[model samples]
Target: MSVPFALFTHCGIYEARVQDTFFVADQPLDDGNGNPPAGWGNPYQSGTITVTGQRAVFHDDLGHTVTFHERPGATSFLKLCA
Candidate 1:
C-alpha cells in the first residue's frame, strides 16, 4: 500500500474514525504527568498507522507497531489511552 500522509490533531481532527492508516509526524509530551504546553502538535511520529475499530495502530519507520486507544471527546482535544 502507498504511504499515507502525516496527520496531527492540531488541524482540528479531534474525534473521528480514521478509516485508513496515516502518520502522526511527531510525539507529544506525556499528558498523564502534565498537560503539554500550547502548540505541541501531538508529537507521536511520522509513519504509517492502521486505524480501525476503536484504536489506532502506529507503525514507525522501523516497522514497529505502536497501538493507541481511541476515546470519545470533543473535536478540540484528545483523551489519551489510560
Candidate 2:
C-alpha cells in the first residue's frame, strides 16, 4: 500500500515507507544538541522502505534488510508537518 504517511517516527521510532524514504541503523542517535528524537541520518538516502498495514520494512541499496519496529508516540503532528 502506498501512503504519504511515509518517513514517520511512531512513538520516537522511525519507519520508512522504501518507496517514500530510507534509514540507516548506525547513524547518529542524535545530532549532539539534544535535538530530541525521530530526526536522524541523512535526509536523502540510497535505500528504500515499504509499509504494509501497521508494519514497515527497510532495505539498503545492496538489498540488505534493516528492520526497526514502530512505537506509539504521544506527540501530535504540526500543521506544516501534517
Candidate 3:
C-alpha cells in the first residue's frame, strides 16, 4: 500500500511543533471526513493557539487562521502480534 499523508502510526502523534515559517500538528485534527487543517499546512509557522470550550483556534502570523477540534472519540489503537 502507498503511504498515508497523515502518517499515523502505533506511537501516534502527540505534538504540533512550530518554528519560523513551519508548523506540524500530529493528531486526529478533525473528523475522518475531508476537512482543512486535518494534518499539516504551510505558511503557518509563527502565531498563536487559542483554546476555548471544545475548540482550538490556530492563527498564523500571515493573517491566516485554522480552527481545530478533535473528533469525538478520536483515538489510536494498536495491536501487536508476536
Candidate 4:
C-alpha cells in the first residue's frame, strides 16, 4: 500500500477528494479588535484536523464530530469511526 495524498492550495483551500464529496475546512481569524489586516483578516481556522480513510475529523478547543462516508483509502477511517 501507499500513503494517502493531500494538497493544500492557496486562498485557504484544502483539496482532499476520493470518489464522493470532498472536504473543505476553513476558519476565520480576527485582529483582536474590529480592525482588519492586509489579506490576513478573516484567516481560516488553524485547528488540529485529520482525515483518515472516509472519516474526516476536526478537533479544537471545542468538541468535534466524525463524518462518516464511503471514502476510499485506508482502514483507519473505519476503526476511528467504529
Candidate maximizing lDDT? 1
lDDT of 1: 0.43
TM-score of 2: 0.34
Candidate 3 lDDT, 1-82, residue by residue in tens? 1111222222222233222222234343433333334333421234566655445556554564554444344343222212
Query: Model 2 over residues 3-48: C-alpha lDDT tens digits?
Result: 3332333233333424333332323233344332433334433455
Q: Provide TM-scores for the models.
A: 0.40, 0.34, 0.36, 0.29
Clashes of 1: 7
Candidate No. with top TM-score? 1
How does candidate 3 score on lDDT? 0.37
* Candidate 4 lDDT by residue in tens digits, 1-82: 2223332222323233343546533432224453222343133323354557655544434342223333344333221110
The alpha-carbon deviation from the true structure for residue 25 of candidate 2, after best TM-score superposition, in angstroms, is 7.5
Q: lDDT of candidate 4 vs native?
A: 0.36
| lDDT ranking from best candidate downward | 1, 2, 3, 4
**How many pairs of residues collide in model 2?**
6
Question: What does each candidate score in C-alpha RMSD?
Answer: 8.0, 8.1, 12.3, 11.9
Lowest lDDT block of 10, candidate 3: 1-10
lDDT of each: 0.43, 0.38, 0.37, 0.36
- Give the TM-score ranking, best first: 1, 3, 2, 4
